[model samples]
Target: MFELIKKKLKHTDGYPYLLSILEHCLQMTYKRNGSQLQQWQLLDRILQQIVLQDEKGEDPDVTALENFNVKNIIKM
Candidate 1:
């Protein structure tokens, strides 16, 4: 299921959509049982892809912090 979604998103425009899907999968992993490890692994792979796709060549830490800050603001 996750692979299918990821493959579909791979052809689409914008990293925001990928980020949103990653966030959703992260939340689901936390809320579900039995498959937590698999979900985390998938999320890790997705994060790697995001970093590779990043055009600014920013440090991963900085990019992650910026993403977290934006998400926090969106929640508030």
Candidate 2:
């Protein structure tokens, strides 16, 4: 098995082309923090909804909380 692997590695056709394709694949490296749905900008909107109901000073529309769907903004 080792001999076969060595032979395949030494004889890879179009190795340069394969390398160029692999290099492109490495470009999309991702960094992540602990924030799920990292929509930091949307934080203010949600906060206003919970803190200040409306311009007329009504109660917060808390029922809409049940309809909140993270999937609507991002896919798993």
RMSD of each: 11.4, 19.2
11-71 in candidate 1: lDDT tens per residue? 7785567778667865773534445554565557557656666577655454544434333
**lDDT by residue (tens digit), candidate 2, 1-76:** 7466456665677456546655754663444653332444244446557576766778566665566765554444
Best by TM-score: 1
**Candidate 1 global TM-score:** 0.30
User: Which 10-residue window in model 1 sums to the lowest lDDT?
Assistant: 67-76
Model 1 has an lDDT value of 0.58
Candidate 2 Cα errors over 4 Å, as ranges: 1-12, 32-76
Displacement of residue 26 (Cα, Å) in model 2 is: 2.0
For each candidate, what is the lDDT? 0.58, 0.55
What is the lDDT for 42 in model 1? 52
Cα-based TM-score, every candidate: 0.30, 0.25
Error of 1 at 50 (Å): 2.0
